[model samples]
Target: MPMRRLRPRPALPSRRKAAATVVAAALVGGAFVGILSLTGTPHAPSARAAEGTGAGEHVRAKALPADAHGKSGKPGRPVRGVRPPVSVVQIVAHPDDDLFFMNPDVSQSLHSGNPLTGVYLTAGESDGVNARPRDAKAAAPDKAGYAEARQNGIRAAYAEMATGSRTSPWDRSAIPTKGGGWAELDTLRARPQIRLVWLQLREAGSVNGDRPYSLHGLWNGRIGVLASQRAAGTPVPTDFAYTKEQVVATLTGILERFRPTFVRMQDPSPGTYPKTGRFRDHQDHLYGARFVQSALARYAELPGHPHVGVQNYLGYPTSVLPHTLDPETADAKLRTVKTYAWLDGVHDCGTDAGCGDLKVAARPGGRGWTQTVRYARGTSTSWVQRDRDGGLHAFSVLDGRLAAWRKPADAVAWRGPELLPGGGLDSGVTSVTLPDGRIAVFGTRTTLGDSATDYRREVVTTVQDEPGGGFGPWLSLGTPEPDDASGTSDISAPAVTVAPDGLATVVLRDSRHRLTAREQRTDGDWDPWRPLGGTDVYGDPVAATDAEGRGYVFASTPKTVLAWAAQSPGEPLAGPAATGLPPTTLALSASAAPDGEGVRLWFRKPASGDLRSADFSGTGPVSPVTELPGTGVAGYGPVSGGDGLVAVRSRTGFLATAPHGRSGSRPVWTLEKFLFSGAPDAGTDGVAAIGLDARLHWTPAGR
Candidate 1:
């Protein structure tokens, strides 16, 4: 049945008339011509989405997000020199999952000096032997021995990332999680802050674990006690079995301990029970991630949990796609994987779990994953923030430097490739207009050492003292993981909300994936970084101001959307209670609800790549989630809004804009070839995209 939503609560009277006129004229040819007509400017063909395109090709509103010509509007090949600010904690099914599916990203994080922690769910004892194929004297299958070897390989690779030596010693210790399980923690002796936690659970051993001996069994209620398979040569002698509930609690305990701001997980949506085809990940990878998802959900409900962000990687699935990583990045990723594969001679760590997986060693270049990296939800996470004037500014990281471009409030021509006063800023950026009109840019910036092993990432900021004025020097807002010996931490792009009185609160996901914040006091001083308390928030933070000038913050977890709002401006923030939204893609766009009664949220339904939205009036329950008109590969990105206009991009790389409430499933203005940085700033002059060609693509306001 064709779903009928309440026609997006009709626009205001005069604007409604303008829309009616547009519809009347547009009905003659199609919504395309009608929308273009509203702009009252000649439309040009779009070719710069991915690969450059020629002009004169007609772009239309009714078309899907991607161009039929194969211009997918993917973000320009990622700028190579910059580092990611995201502190990453990858929880995977085996020792090499990070190398295989989460490459480049894993390597990039380490190389950029971001604090990283890897959690392995199982021993990965496929044949249970830790021997290279070329070694004729290799031992027979011994799960414990093989697990130890894998751990050795992982440690070597991680140590190299931290201190430039594969054989760097580690301080191995057993830590008890809140869920009543003991985990092996290996902290690098050279870099004590970076560590690996091994749970050493038994593997399912097959795609379908019908025997009830696997994570699948535990998740499906087929098994209550999943036993631990301890790795060899470990000082901790005891082993234990966990009930289904205990497993989730165990994972949750780890989350609480690590408190990752961003969690990298294998895709958990396997689509069907008897998994088939591309959408399915390994059963363990799928279910193990499901366990993590379960943990995140449970953790989020805790009163004082940190906001955790999540990013899911397409495992095995990435092997078939075109390479997403640049050659340099991919090659760097391969080297790290090769280390885990023990491509270099193995270090004889005396134990049952041998040096590393020989199968991967024999083919260390890797089947598919080592050569590329793909985010299940698509990447281009940069945002473009705007202010009250018609003028708009776009910010991005170019060659590790924060770059800015501004379209003057009164003119259409964009100007400035102006570099902000910092070189180590993270790739994507977040900006907020202060109450005084100064634009403040917030991001987790990285300081690259002379070598890949020397790096430090922290949340920092720089703001324009006045609109269109020069920006002050990059300012230190500080990092969440300040005292970690590694000196690097995972923090999400900032979500800074400015109140009418000019009070601003900066929200971020700490290394633990917990939501933390720092607010500006009336004395012009900022508060210390502190947890505001929410969990499993695996995406960028978003916020909007209510009529009362109170700020409301929202974040998405694997299961649902959670929100926290200030009872009043400058008051301690409260209530990250559930907002009643369903599972959503990590990306979200939000604005003040048109009715002034609540806030409206725009996001993609996970995996569906369909636009979805919901509204919550502070007085009542959230409105039902409604699907918007978008079905594509990338899902949705950041959104920009102002002066009653809102703009967004579908995952399929389409550009869309509409009057505040009027953009539901059907947006009023769409340009199919409009691929851009996720952040779109809308103002009286028009809607604009920081083009893939590194130019500003602007369309005049429809009304």
Candidate 2:
């Protein structure tokens, strides 16, 4: 009777236009937002905060404002960011864009519990089929045994999301993809920090009007006729022909073997827009987002590449839109991938892949499934630190602009490329920080029109540190202006914290999707945006603050997965509940509790790909949630060293975690190895510090 308590929300709304159209229709319905939580709520228990009323002040006096400058009401100010160790890797392209576009940043870097690995890149064999559901001898079988039954249905869904028991059995191995051709690779192993590698290939073709092998004849600049296999021999075994630079050198040799920081693909933009019908997305998601942007520009000219982060998802018809799930932390990510039973066959769920070929087989008349959905990368990022000298930073934004990412070794006398001054980054730059030390960076910068709700505005770029330290060039808080027209405004991708008096609270998702909270008046300015309101969830809103500074924001909508409070100094927050997530979600990050608890949210469940957690307990709600193993394609893990740790650069090498207590959620250390071949510089002491692989390892925070 779960499915969110047999579907309760009898019309909830209210948390500011349901947080901008249900977290922008569950991020453009990717992973079909897990079939929009297949109707899940029966666990109850949540909903509390009401006595002398002060769970934090019932939505900050009505969503905050009065000049709202730095406290996120914004007038000016800015500043600085990790968790990482070794033994972890994740390289994605299909089989659940790493469970919803590299989810919860690959389930908060596998709960920092370490030892993880994943690399799929196609055997996502499309319709020729496999995640089961095809009867008549499996519909039309023999496409190389339905590509080995969709590689044993993603090895029983990554052995039931990394070892919960999917019967554990894969070890295949055929490898070699960049032109020499071969493809087969599969490995599952339940523990020792998990593992899954697939490699299949083939999918591509389809520009919208699918018919005669399309992706517009293999990425409009036609190269190997879109994943050649022409003669459609069925399920790529290759007659030994390749060349799209040998399939981008068999995906740049799986990115020089596990050199991933975050890379999730699909939606390469020309999904066919000419008349607009099929161009909304798909063509093996635009040749897998242009072959992972030409294998990350050849993994940044090889020689040790790994500080990479990319996510894109959204195909089919973006599922009519609106379902969102940050309902105060979507029931702690629905208790980390639970529900699936739904009364009968759920495909029997024994081997763990527990059936979810986009869902439907729950039995009793069935028909509820909606294309086994999985879309990701609608932009949701995290990274922090503003002062203290160690410098190291990044606040992220893509497709909407507002960037920042510093490190050239951060200190110990480092040297080069962290500079990126103003010039309006223009695309979706979700969030960035420096709240009090002074270099802020929030995102979303497109205005002119054409969907994304015609682009409203919520930018906020700042950088003014010099006097003896470093950064000084950028500035633009400019009066909450961002209205580009306001179709309810649509905002997420902004989360900054900084209190203890220095001011700065910033958390986002406005246009009334609520979760607002803008306060920065110690003289810095920003004051009018208020409303830590509640109800509605799905995220791209992450915030952190502890060591006494107070604040916390988290979010993730659709009806649960929450966190929002302030607790003191003029208070006004503390009312929002439920956090039992996991029915398929990806994107939500938080960390600021260095040793114990105050804030710690991170997600990713794409049905059972795993990686989940919860902690923030100022009164009740968020706790007891856990699940960790591996899966990441983008959410660009690693970058946050304000105290409690977080760092992830997967493909199976370099992981970090800290999470802490309430007795559930795990990961206090998991490192895999030389995590990032290039990008990584965490060290708020928990140390992640990477850049050019050379094989390093330190991984330990676990206990």
Candidate 3:
């Protein structure tokens, strides 16, 4: 989230980073989504006024059918009681951080049905008065009162987004944190699913300033105990202090209680001006996100905890990149920001954080920069999948829609670029082969409402009309957490495969970031959505079928990999059972293990991003993870074939390949001149990726 600049304060001496582990970066985008539903879940269905009644009024969702043009248009059945299962916890340094950095997503998730929890690390006691300087000259600053008012404004905005009313009453209470201090927690009265937690700690007075007693000081070893800047209306008896370890422990405790599938915070790696050497984001934002990252590691290691994904947003500098959000999505984001600012001259919150930031409320649409969002380190793996006939079928999101291409076993060059129909699809899609040889293209569709803010992301698929021809119209498999579209960014790209009975099974990360699956029956109808029981899964899922035709789906957490296997065709999937492997990049590749009873998983190790592998044979234990000895390998692969063909990137970002298959083998990876993004498709034909120039580049395995 961007830091709202306060009045010109004295510039304090700049201190260097506190620790070497701090991921000081401009962008490190890893795909994570939060599901929103039609109810109080992150995605609210309508703008119904909050009556403060415990029973929330439901907004019926509109169903869009295909028009004559084969695109979304005609009205189908409206999905009611469609509650999404995902939850989101947003950690920011101040009140407006989410608005400035993570909206559109925030608005979308809330509209979809993912429950939300926002944690504000500081009280944001900026100059303390709710009024402007010109009007507050005669009044003393009320830090406590001002903080309360700001929180009230936040409650109003959150209520409106989740329940369509700013006056949604909140049950506020004090909760004890592991840090040995009391933090304020608020729950929505009508929609008990939404929550807010306030740490109410002191804010730094200046940008790039170092304090011996603030979050920065604690992070850097300059402070032993930091005192609280309690919100006056909070239900704590006495003010308390927190040590550095205590603070980390306390955030960790909050995470344990929430068990959030998705976690978001401001940029942890906020570098400084190149020439001036000044920090980019606020000291609190950088340090606060770092603490959260540290807490996440601890949380992930806990025995019995669910898998959780983390998304670190870009700070101020994102403005310079190309506008990533659609115009409608961007507009919806600003509207929410305006709501938080209370820009419509509304005073519904009644308490002091003084409705909202009047300064920003007066100018809700800040410079065009606020409309843009970008992520760092996005490695887009290819969507190329090989079918039984040895023909290649590939899918990509072209011009905001799903596009298809084919290469026949008897043909030389790839076939026509057949554009399939699906709207609001993310940048990529996945495809799988059926037992009959026809290919099925699967994707997460984004259905947009009249207002961009109202959106939905659902699992969708379409089969090839003829063996090597264009695909049929899109089929809506529907989301388990069918939301009104407050948000659905948490949904992952699909990992699909076919069962022995010719049934098509598609697996993907649900709105809740869990592994979920749906299968097409003999009648060509899809089964209802259900969880495969894995957590913290990210990006595109990877699936492989053993010799028995039992399908194995693998999902990568920030630190570990989990697999769910199919018992039989037309039967429920089981076993998100742990693979007992160490952490990997959110990306991974899986192929049937040579033993025919298990699967081989390939991924890059964290910290070094070195390509590594372990064999899972559905036996007693997985083999010890062995490093695929190589230097300068920055990412994992589009791993394919029983004889694995791996893709790797150099430390300098050039892409290349390495072979790893035979037992006890240590093949070396050499850097090539090709500059590629996404995974390289490796098969009997070759490896392919979108080059730096944005064109698909193909390299034969012989090279």
Candidate 4:
């Protein structure tokens, strides 16, 4: 599509002067209390009153009632008997964070005919210039005006995505937050189910610089309160501030009111560069997500809340990785960015702030951001396991608990995504079958203490007391890293293997990109964690057993794959052998070889989603690699299943499956329409995935 051009509207002298005064006062004392119209025209009270409920009700920040800070109610207490409907709430740091990191999924949710709410924590008023650096007519630093323009652009983009029209009208108003501040709420007139909320808090301004006024500083207690930067035309009549506790309370209150069934946020632990020790993502994206994490923890304790599933999206780091979307999906995503960037230069939104974010118009794709979307966690392929009796069991972390689903050996239907008792479980849960037929589930858990310094992520597990029975209490397997400050809690999800003698080993990649392991002794006690010796290891590790009863663990670096193996059934693992494998996309999965002699490793070619595999005997040179025949479909993430069937993500961000190992007959991939979380799991009986709607979806064998 070609960019459109339109005539610019003349600036109104009175409104322009008022905006300049507001900016000057803000710079003088680091506080802003003035209000100015961004559109050069005052909002009519009649128009606001006709929009929606509470549209014209404006409240001053100084007059909030004392009861506004009331508790979110008792923990684990249900006030309603019926479960709430499926609703999604995405909390992000800035306007485009969701568009850049969570799209395709965001668009799919909008199209699902369910309610979706987007909450932006920051004003995104970077440098306050609404034009490219080269633009001669770039506006001066007016933070409030710039923020308002970005909000306008986001509204246009969301309206077009939901109602197929960029000019869709919205009912804009102010809502008093549970945090003692007012947030701007906008609801699309055409689709009342879609909403956008702006917290209007000050942005960090720099990508990684240490700014004490930003969320990072507030989180670390370097600042007492983070002040708001109300947009020029926001319905919120006055500015306010939020303490760390107040921010969490606000989010918890939102959760209680909206009661969303799924939540999306940026990655709190995006890790750091191994060489420079710089953050891999914007500091706001990281620390802002930490606040969301805290809120979710508090909300989980409140009464009458629906079960929620969460997915974290990768931000700036995705630019360096392989693109995950196919051309068609990428193009669709780019169109939305163009709308938000105001690339067409059409001033149709009736705003003197220019309708969209002009600064983004210079480079709408955001340094390759528009072309890819990747999950920061929950991509493990070991989530499914077959029991000794031919039953299949799948596990996923939902609502801070273990959600288990099972299909009996003789039954045609899958039943019970029954959540096990306990909380604090993070995304991604892997399972392994014990020698006695019992199953053990492994995952990482986050603990949000009263202080920021107490935030931590640790490995935890629960196993069935007996085969096909209930699970025991969650057992903690302390993290190898000292704390969140030094490591940013960048540990990978646990990958486990159980030996023939009933000894189990759990392997994980730590913050320093090295492998660490904790083994289970024959007495049922765990050993202290120790380094396994691998460098630059990225992504989660995978473990599997061979026909000879030896266990192997594998992880990937940017260059090649690394392997460690146990010599015997219950021996210590040794060697970080260079497998001589070509560079992969850092996604790996393993299953028993059809010949019953060794284990087969599956991975994707870098930048090319074609499947590749090789057989490994755990302690020797690897076998020659073989490429699976292509079916014109390509996507990232670990591919599951062996010779009988395979499940993978298709180019369209949907689940797909095909028959494997059929000679002379090309595999035909059948695609599912829904988007799903984590990776797909396949067995001889069927394939399964956790849908984005937080439910289990199954495709039986031979369908």
Candidate 5:
């Protein structure tokens, strides 16, 4: 027996008249055009949804709020530099998940002035109840309306971040998603640089070992036994008919269009819940993550698809774990901890859409909101490369400059010979091969006076060429002269990237810390530094050039790996384009390698304790690429350079590689450890390993 279908909603008086007029005209024009649209075009609805497009008949009409737009219709700011070579696309199960977990990267990309997009899989509708602050006039604010509340909350949050105003109005329009569901999307909030893609699927209840039935169990095929019952009086409908493939297709369609360079999703593992032996994370979060993994597999098979970087964020159960933040910016974010935790007035109202959903007001004295720290604060790390032969050099403040290693098979493995420069190695040291083949290193330095507070700011550069690759001397590059000193004060280490033009551009994240660029002439002449007007990125920034000779910058804060590029030559780089990053304590290191006709970014994710790669091939953003695990802390070369095959040291002393421009699961080469520079010898064969003696083992490609 065929299942009975629901009746279609009656058209409004005016719409009915309009349809009649259209039908009359169509009849006069004949059936050819009608047949084409009905059978071949995307305009045709599926047989089951022929009448109402799957959302069902009598669709509830919620007057969408005003469309949010900046004066121009574009979202966000225009990227100043040549368009970025790497694209990034971030995907998450719910709205605000990126901000809460993959942020700094998301925010960083917007500032990178690059093309980026965010895709939310679910409407993130929680309990549907919008809670109000206790101090409000109305004690019991409302009983139900969680979905609307979440919508309001997310829109407010997005509007605030995009347009620089939380009060920005949103114009909502229903866009049909795969499986016939409708997504009410928000239009431009900031500038048009950023776009919000929402697939308004229902949210699953958190399985805190409490809920008997949930969306998680239903999606996994447990059906009635593990599913939540529907509310009797609610008009909002629920369906458990979607298959795993249908859900993946919904996401796949979004990816096909965006082609992001990065995709951030919640941790699928959800780790183990401390209190309950079961997975601590909500079942939805886990399943959603697995669904994403499936989509990635499909995406990887697509021709000309962008290289995507995937970042897994810690979830609710892992919230209590130690985490890290951009040292300099941690305080500013910490200020909002109270607001995120408590039911403050800030999250109370939804000026445009009503209160947003997702999270509910915390119970009295409950575990309030808190920032997750990945690593200990103020732990400084750097990637030092030998200019002599482009070998890898890594330095950390782990035990102060006392830890220095050199590459040599004879040296003892894993043992450090602290090479404390007479004046202490400056913070943020990066290596660059000079036109003359000499290795140049740059970092920030401060001159101490008699008093602890007495100090002067300065930028310093050094040169090294030899077996030990010891620095020759420090040449002062003058002060960046920043405007703010909230707590810490020091000019950032200059970010150096040898452009395709052979001219070296030294960029710095300044004290008030704007990004400034200076060029080192191939003739050895230095240009006066100029401000690039992007947000201050808080870590060691790396730069690379695309096939078109466009300059790009890749940097890391405690939260993300960000890329910047100019729209064209002589223009400032775009605001930061995000590397879909999770909150990690990774001392990030990045290098660009040839990708077919362009360049791709090979990065190390310290948080995951492995090396990974991604490329930007589209106009939107990069996609997430699965990391090839094996290399450990020793296998890492935190700072890596070279093309074709690249080299990086893992903390565990193993070297690994993902062939240039290739995707899918492939085996990686793990090089044997030989003590060289307290680490492994960096290589160009795309393989290198680190040892205790600092001596690096290098293997030429194919040799």
Candidate 6:
């Protein structure tokens, strides 16, 4: 295809002006950022802005009566109900990374008609061979041509997703990056809301091999400035090199320009086998994600940008895990890949370099990528809690800090997602309510230091000093692994449960896939970390308390679920007994049974979205599993249950819910068509989720 004429660079808008315009548009439209109904309608903002404080202001918690039930008396500063418009910015290592790992999501966001931008860090010119080995007539190695072909494929795929046709034209232009380089920018003409940015940096030829000039080398300080590889027929006029600081600055520039409400990237710490010393994902994916992480840290420090929620997607490692998508969803995902791979081998795109990456034509799906989508972090379902006064409080990590949202028992609308004070908190936050009604929130925090080796992750928690009161300072709970190098900071999000005596126990799966925990003493001191005896454990562990006040914890392996239950109230947990269950999709949730018989464990069957549950009274054998009637909306993730209600992610990437105990009868699932981060949390009066727009959305009971 002939390259489109480059458009003149437009004057950039100031950050403050841009931010104000977004907020005004959203408020005038009566909708929160990034939220859309099933019919693509925007829901009205549920609450008016607080009178005195700004929307992002921090509200000081006031103390309530010791025995108060969910009442916070009078709100200090209500959370700002009006939020800025929502936009998404995704950064990946290569052209097809978003399609392989972040899709269904990418496609769904496009359907929502929100502003979405994808940024590619490198020119994926691998071996310069655009065809499979069997195609002898394929052209000789032309790195520039291969890169251009890949770009064409990506454009076609995204166009088909945004508009209805793959032939939709795009407006091509060049933009100056903060990293002191020029990047090619393509905007879909049919739907101006969608865009693609190409940095055109050099990619490592080998996936796992030692490439001294690659992103991995630069990240590890083995190289200075990595040179760029401009694609053939690109709009960029000249090539450039980027040092570590420059690369981060470039990404930070993109974030500032877009001011996205949600940011997506690959997993920085995909983990490695200690014995084999093999990384779980491609080196470029890992190192590139690290650069994005650093850029996000820098972006968070700058003012005027909207608060953003971060989601890290699992990359190549999803191949080894069981398929998370059903046939229908998987097939849809495969169709997009086929378009990107130019599987039909048609030259319809008019590109002499070939329409797409023909090398992927032989296996368009690429391992098991198209069949599954898994999150590397932020899968915790314990983020929502009911306080003593029967009010609801929901928590999520936004801009590397704890964001709290509350709904009073007497109020019709929710309030305050007012962010807490500190930062560096990672995704996947969990919480537990103490006997006295105080709630404690837990999460892992990433500490980035001067050197790459200084990167570290450790558990930290903050608790309300009294019911409905201000939270105390964050307390650090050191990691079980000795350091970041050994563990790659691959610890699971903390699963905590408060005992009847008011003590708390935090459980987590260590880097070696073993369960370890710490117990709180009467004097408010914590016990040293101790192993809980389990191997091959994967995913985050869950903790729950039964009617008898006993605490139960469960973690899943590829084959079965393992359990660790307290022998008595206020005591250490016992054996990691086998649950004798079948393989699961690695997502687990727990809640007390309605009958008060035992702690009920909820999970999905392997390769299917069917929900199943079994009651565990103690460490003894669990009750026979019971399958819930399918809502016909297949999805993979933890299911949150409370007050006889359950909330799950539906196949359409929306929140779906059904009441518990409708066995034999098909329950009507109330589906909400908004894409959200982390897991949905269910409470007595409502279901809550953190929307991609970085705001908390609550669905009242019976809605």
The superposed Cα distance between candidate 4 and the true structure at residue 328, in angstroms, equals: 3.1
The whole-model lDDT of each prediction reads 0.57, 0.40, 0.56, 0.72, 0.42, 0.74
Candidate 4 lDDT tens digits, 633-660: 6666778855466778766556777766
RMSD of each: 17.3, 23.7, 22.8, 18.0, 28.0, 13.6
TM-score ranking, best first: 6, 4, 1, 3, 5, 2
Off by over 4 Å in 3: 1-382, 387-390, 410-412, 415-418, 484-489, 593-598, 617-621, 624-630, 635-644, 668-672
TM-score of 2: 0.30
Preferred candidate (TM-score higher): 1 or 2:
1
Where model 6 places Cα greater than 4 Å from the true spot, the runs are 1-84, 136-139, 616-629
- Candidate 6 lDDT over 1-703, as tens digits, reads 1222112121111000000011111111111122100111223322321111212221112111121111222234433323335699999999999999998889889987889999999999888878876973666888999999999999999999888789899999999999999999999998998999999999988777889798988988999999999888799999899998999999999998888889999988787787976777888998899899999899888866667889999999788777788788889889999999998887877768888988888898999899888888888877877776767777888788887867676755456556788888888898777777788899999888887888888899999989888899999998898877665788898887667787889999888889999999999999999999889888888876544455667788878777776654577876576666677888887764434333345677666677666543322222344444444667777777655677888776777776664224344576665678889887556677777767666665664
- The top-ranked prediction according to lDDT is 6
Local lDDT at 634 for model 1: 28
* Per-residue lDDT of candidate 3, residues 1-703 (tens digit): 2221112121111010000000001111111111100011111211321111001111111111111111221222223232223456789888877777766456545664557789998888777866644566766788888788778778887888888888889999988899889899999998888899999888875667656667878776677888888877888767988887888898899988887655666755444543454665677886787677667656755654433434556666554333434345556667777776766666667664567766466556655434654332122343565665666765555333564545565644443234445554544555565555566667666553433234455777787776555578888887766543222234566776566676767777764567777877779787776677766555567765544455556676766667665554335456676655666545666543333333445555443434555543232322344444333344222333333455554333344555545555554554444333345555445555543222333444544
Superposed model 1: Cα runs more than 4 Å off: 1-389, 449-454, 484-488, 594-597, 622-660, 663-665, 672-685, 691-693
Q: Model 3 reaches what TM-score against the true structure?
A: 0.47
TM-score of each candidate structure, all chains considered together? 0.50, 0.30, 0.47, 0.83, 0.41, 0.87
Candidate 4 similarity to native, TM-score: 0.83
lDDT of 2 by residue, 160-277 (tens): 5555554566555555655576665555544545556555555552334554343334433444444432112223345454545566676777766766544545544322222333
TM-score winner between candidates 1 and 5: 1
- C-alpha RMSD of candidate 2: 23.7
- lDDT: which is higher, 2 or 5? 5
Q: How would you encode candidate 1's per-residue C-alpha lDDT over 529-605 as one tens digit per residue? A: 88988765565676655444556677767677677766545575665666556666566666544443334455654
Sliding window of 10 residues with minimal summed lDDT for model 1: 16-25
Report the Cα lDDT for residue 65, model 3: 13
Question: Given candidate 2, what's the lDDT at residue 535?
Answer: 50
